[model samples]
Target: MVVRSLAAPPTPWSKNLVEPKIESSAFVHPFSNIIGDVTIGANVMVAPGTSIRADEGAPFYIGEGTNIQDGVVINGLEQGRVIGDDGKQYSVWIGKNTSITHMALIHGPAYVGDNCFIGFRSTVFNARIGHGCIVMMHALIQDVEVPAGKFVPSGAVITNQQQADRLPDVEADDREFARYIVGVNDALRAGYLCASDEACITSIRNELTSTSSSDSSNGSSRNISTSSMMTSPYLSQDTIAQVRNLLQQGYKIGTEHVDERKFRTGSWKSCTPITAKRESEVIAELEACMANHAGEYVRMFGIDPKGKRRVMEKIIQRPDGQQIAQPAATKENSFSGSYRSYQPSVATTSATSGQINQDTVAQVRHLIQQGFKIGTEHVDERRFRTGSWQSCTPISASSESQAISELEACMANHAGEYVRMFGIDPKGKRRVMETIIQRPGGNQIAAPSNSHRSSAFSQPQPAPTYNNKSSASSTRLQPEVVEQIRQLIAQGNRVSAEHVDQRRFRTGSWTSCGPVDSTSASAAIAAIESFLSEYEGEYVRLIGIDSNKRRILETIIQRP
Candidate 1:
């Protein structure tokens, strides 16, 4: 029952008596407070203003090679307070090579596993910290159970109990302190403390021993409710199996198995019922077992080993919850094919049927026989069969002779019409006639004659002469000659003639006059001039005709 008062004078001599089992070879600041039942392991360094207190009830234990930076406070409160056993007390357990940074407070009833990092100003309280966890700066932790290897980010506030709906008024410094504590706890649960399994186990065992002592010293009754009791972390394997079997039988895990006498006392409805405590303990034990077999469970269940076990419990609730097996196929052979249905319709008859041309058919047959496929080489076979060879057949030697003769006749008529229309042969008449002959349906013509020799011979005959002056001037030309003149102009040609035969040919309109003369040459010139004056709008300029021939040209250029 050694009790030390907070107000007691500092004793320098006690330092000699309480020599460290493994003292830090490095400098430790004089202002820092290091007190009671603490074991600072070898090669550890303690910075200035760092306070470490392992009190009489709960001692503080640090593993080898750990560093305590400036402004760090490592302490342990009463132990054995959680569990009922009186012999053991709570302890602060830190793993090997862990670093506790500036202004970090590590107070227990809390367990920290190995190789964890407690960042600046982290706070921890009554939490089970896992190995290899990281607690960043300014974090708050309270009454939480953190698993191993998690990273608690900076400024995180983790609280196990639900806070009041309305927050209590608190100073900034107090809030800051609370955050630090939470941060430390978070680091512990996240497994930043210990790097290895051995270190983790050692930290947990030390914490358990220390907590046991605190529980005994306080003389607090172990009043675990049935729910809590069943969930205890120390349940036997046989007990866990029993719970599992009961769960399989549809008995809820947390339900009370109350004796009638106990029920009369209204304990069944109590907030912390005895049945609940037992059930809680059982649950805890089951969880621990599952945690131990977590790797195996994850492999079987396809879940993370360190994940929450509620999901695992649900999965295990049904007996046949394991992966279902697929059935094998029984039939050995199968056949598949595509099928289509069709319907027939009545045909219609043609109104006017024509015979296919034997000549054209023979030509097509020859083409086909010469390795030309019907559908591939030619198009519109039905039309080709009925029409004249000129309509559908390609030009052959036989077709060419007929075509040439037809073309020659067409050219002759065109030439004759053109000369008669313009009163002279037109320029480029031969080319224009050739073009007309070459057009798709324009190839056919009457047989060529000796008159079709050359352009010189194709010129129009001379016009008949007229004598009376006034009568000649008033005479109207034949309409056929006028039409011929129109055709000649349209054929892109020049026309010229000898005499003005008004009785034989007439200038239809006398809108304008030309030079009058009685001689054959003069009358021809006068007639040409008169024609030009009447239809000057037809040819604005004569390209090839000279000024001497202008009078004759003008008459020829007149519009019909």
Candidate 2:
């Protein structure tokens, strides 16, 4: 392991300063960066481009058999100091047998426990991740404690405490769900522990070959558990068919689509008996298969395969779980006549043959009309794929350029009508129309003014004006307006449109206020401290206004 430090000496009085300490058995790739106060335990594999910078606030501690995968960035919390009971600093403390995948960030005060898998591009900031947790791709975990055995889905942002508490219910997978990932890492760690590159490769190859051969030979002789059968992708076609048949009859496929595809079924409680001791045997088999097939999977499915590892980790409920009833169609073709039918492009000429011409604009337009999306680049590559121009003719640069210019011209001529014909929403139509109109020599057609409510893209509304004669010093807020604000604050609500209106005039049941613009409301919220002092008993605190200019106030209730 290559260990270099940036630990500088502190003042004579402050006694706590340490250098980067990595165990002898640990494997730190040459490209990996280790900065101040980072401690790595035995058999830890730090992959290429991984950076562990324990520079600020606290130190970092990576536990044994943990794999810090490629491009992973772990840092000490920049702000808070979370000191332990032992008087030691707490930073990004990752537990044993954890696998932190590529591009994942762990900014500390983060405590990730044992047997956890932090998926690709996932983030952990100022949070506690319990044991056996699986945080999937693109998930942002900030300032929230994730419980043990919970699965965080892709693109899920668990920023609030309440969201964290309800995470387990959202995740279908439990402790055993991704336990295989840690086992795979353990094997990889052992290989990296070898003296040389050749030795490591040989060791891994020998182990996998032996295991695969043994498993294949003893397949019929050994008893397989339900969990193993469910997860194993290499099960016999007959067994797979039988499982699929069973699931089709009366079962809900709650697991990830990929895993479900493998088992032909999903999260079924009745499938496995918890009372039986054989479940452990199944899990053991699963771990073995995972470790053995790790290399093959990395090759077959690159990294972060199409399975719902992050999003669909939680087992889906029963098929009958609160399903909304839809009207059953008597005929197979339930779609309306308005739905456009797809057609293949007619042009069969290849661009390589130099048959490409300026008439390509018409051809391109035809392709688009037939439901093709043409990008400026990769027109040559995406010809055979869905949503691409499926014409027999290859797209040349000149042809593509001309087509793009023509499309732009068409947009410039009548953007609103084009977007309307293309079934774009009101908001999207406005955006497209704005973009077109903003461009030089483009059309400036207004939005459709058919509705009662005028749009920003339609005829613009005249700005509302307050009584200009009323001086700021003499403008006293109405008694009812003060009462409305008080009631809203008491109810833990901001001065929103739901409770109060911005206008001086009353519109039906909405509580009207004296003409108060956003600037005036902001000043009013700030001056609430002085206003509360004038009151006899009620305590008041002015919370800041939100982006929508809704005033937030708080009433401090006195205890009886």
Candidate 3:
């Protein structure tokens, strides 16, 4: 093996030529390469083609009885360092009895605890794998520390805390399987050393020519796993069938996703659009997008190219702490006439119906789960237009039913007035959301009045889709979502709208459609309706500016 020392960089703390301190009992194959400041403990086996280089991020440690299989790479960045199990800092630490299988990578600022099994071609970077964990093939573990004894399924992209917290625990069968691999490798370690005898080498040369000829004649029989030949596990039968369904319905497919933080503020960036013409090519493109955004919040939409609007949409990945449901196959003709408009299916009427607005129940549950305090505000129509809000009785509810009961009672007392629901951060003391749940008269006013409308947007508009959906007979502003632009305008806020097609959504290159003046509520609603119909099949959002220029709120009014 190319075991050698190298001079440390010219730094304040490092000033010496460092060498690898390998234990005498460890077997490092001749073809394996070991470099500066690396320590290998007793009984460890480094197979052929394994590379352990600590030249940059120095002082790597491999504990006793660990096996580094062929084609493994252990390298680290020059800057990052991880806290080791013994309370010392290390660039990379592999604890005792761990098995890093073929083609796996253990990048620095990383740690693998004792008795772990890192599967083939998997990667662990800027992260920790707890003791006895089994990370399956092609998985990615980064940025978060996995708890002890958890199991990571194949192709998992774990990059955030929420995902790391929710991983399943390792089972008894999994532990036994990992132990079996270690036992088998221990046998192979002994056998490989004895196979270096002169007689053994002579016998191998006899059939070498024949073996080469046979390999050439029957290459398919060889055990090989290449990236190009493998299908991504994330690209399942259901995803492909969904793609086919969208395409057959004369709708083009597109995808967009965002990390947890950005997804909260209604910001989404698109992935590579499925631009292929052939059926197989489209499926491949779809697969590529799914594989690329495996960990983030991904949204798939069916676009109407001619009109520039989204005809259908669904969230494929829920990164916001929602329980991930497995993708169910879309049945024949089952994908049509369902979910035409974007609405929360779960938030609608369900088991938790009578006490609160079931259509916005998901938000209430989420706010509570995130430890936000719920509150409410009320005002008459005149006060609402003047931005004056009076606080209702403080609701320190721990349960959804309790919170909703208080909210419904508050609205009942202030009937015919405007009441809004809000959630506040106890720590920061800021409102997370302030949505108007009730409007004046507790009724939908006969078609919005057109007086005081912006001259450029003076044309009358048809009834909006929001006014048509309701649980029973009555329709109201969505509980969590206000009447969007119309409600914000009615509240005396200056509303501005922006529109973008499927292509421009990727870059967030929005085109301004102009602002709605502080006019009559009907006029503002009409202006928003005009923008919606004009930009049909596109994404449209309203920015509520509170006139003083200090406060602003953004709400997506329309999306395809």
Candidate 4:
């Protein structure tokens, strides 16, 4: 439904009444508002929230079979009138079969020619739009002349003659875009005309049934019955033809993915896939198209699908024109883990890296908490080392020290643990970190001076203190338990009682497994490998109990 956004000014403007001349056949929807000296031709559809006012200047003329779609605002500016071939004076002239889509603002003296599309939220002020031209969404044309069949990219702003001159020539004179718009409008008009016609709806349904039955019996291709075509008082033969052509082009025509058991053996049937309606599926289809068949895919799924394809195509390509391989499992939230486990390793590494005099370990831990990629090879590549010298700020140490510290952290942590903390492998956590730390430098980072290395590890260290708690009440976390937590944390996940199930980890229940710290960490960790071994190529979740008294779910773990 259309809603008016403006009210009349308190200061009086001219109240002279000039009734709008709208054709009886045209549909000026209840939500659209038409004011003084406006002339709408036959079969035009003035959709919801459209405001066409010719109050201050020459009359506005909308030609036949045009569509003024939702939220279009057409205003007449005070300018010298242009005389048409028919000797009529005009300020704003929209030609036949044109489509002015949602939220576009056209201010006259502007001339929009036949079969043109004024895309979503685009603006045309004192401009000339030639036939079959496309003014894409959010584009602006101010006092400029767009030649016929031209394509204007989204967000393009053409203001002057020089700017207009620089515009590339229209790609093709085929007018495919124009035809598609007209076809869509024609379908809308036909549907609107048929919605209230009970007899017509019944006839169409019968026709569809008969057509399907006949196709099944005769083994013939599907076709619509001519007699049951959408042709009411509101829809002419041209409109029907346009709708039929659109259907033939496969725009939202209802069909199914029929599984013909006799023809194919696969679980999924070899048939036309159902149309994707959800936003996610649309995005997926667009992505698939970009990676494979762009042109054909865009043509099939048309709602600005090609724009995303183009963007992704560019993103996945190197400057040298080679395609970049997408990272298999790099995105944050791909896994999760606890942060407390990696604290000591990070501290020890910092101590070895000559940052023992400062709280570099705390800084690194803070970076991980703040989402930095300190775990992987990206560390050497310097992913987090940019921007202001904050948490990701470079440690004041030699490259050798940094490499050794990063390597120690990677080995001490579980796979995917770095990603959970930092979202990337900053130091090539597995392979590169191992290689770089061993390389020659001033002094080996592994061997910190005796004075600084003294506190790196303590023999029979006391249980971690919290709020001045006593050692009797606080139990020291086992190395295995800490390692388990590290593994879970690296995977970017957390253990909770809610995720426990009968599937994989095979521990009957949290109560049956006894306390979290009671079990050997090796056995619990081994259960993951054992589960995968027992399942043998099948996917399963490895469940276990964490020290926090919650269940841990290692999802869909498939071992090679």
- Scored against the true structure, residue 262 in model 1 reaches a CA lDDT of 30
TM-score comparison, 2 vs 3, better candidate:
3
Q: Which 10-residue window of candidate 2 scores lowest in summed lDDT?
A: 295-304
Q: How close is candidate 4 to the true structure, as a TM-score?
A: 0.38
lDDT of each: 0.38, 0.44, 0.63, 0.45
lDDT tens digits by residue: candidate 2, 1-560? 56645333343322444677889888887667787777888978888788787766457788898889989999865666544434566777888988898899999888888888887798998998887787766778888888887767555667767667655332333343345455566566555456347867787889999998997788764545444555554433332332243233222222111221222111112222212124334334323433443322100000112332221111111122221111211111111111111111112111111212222323343334334443321112122112222121222223332334333333433323311111112332211100111112232323221111111122222222223222122123322233324333434444422121122101112222222223343344334423433432321222333344443321121100
Residues 1-560, model 3: lDDT tens digits: 33523322344434553778989888888778777678899989998888887877867999998999999999888889987778888999999988999899999989999999898889999998889998877778899999999877655667777677777687665675577567666677766765776676567776797798887686654423222223435444444555556676567878777774554333578998777544456656655765677667666666767757765455555543232232321110011232112222223211122324322344565567678888988888655534678998888777654566567667777888877777788997865556666667574211111111101111222322433222111122232233444455555667677887764453244688887774555555556667777898876665666657533454455566
316 in model 2: Cα distance from truth in Å?
A: 22
Candidate 1, 1-560: lDDT as tens digits? 11122322455323333433445443344455666766666656665577776553345667666777779987666553222122344467776667788899887877776666777798987776666666666766668766766555455555643321111232232223333333343344234325335778798889999998886676534545443454544444334544545344333342211222332121222112112224445465334434543322111111112321211111121122221121111110000111001000000000000111112222222322233322111112222222211221222322212222222233333332211101111342211111011112222111111110100101122333334232233223322233223333433333454322222122111222333333243344345546555543432111112223333222222222
Per TM-score, the best of the predicted structures is 3
Q: Write the per-residue lDDT of candidate 4 for residues 1-560, one digit (tens) a residue.
A: 22232232321223674677888888776667777787888888887678887777658899999999889999876765654435687988899888898899998888898888787899998888887777666778887787877766555667766556545444332254456566566667667667657988889999999998887785522223233343232223432332234333333312112122211111211124436553333334323433342221111211123222211100122123232222221111111121001112223223323312222333333334434344333122122112111122222222323433443443333222211112233453321111011111121112111111111211222223223111112233322223333344434434221122332222111112222231333334444334434545332333434345343332222212
TM-score of 2: 0.37
**True-structure RMSD, every candidate:** 45.9, 23.1, 18.4, 23.3
- Model 1 CA deviation exceeding 4 Å by range: 1-20, 24-27, 80-90, 161-560
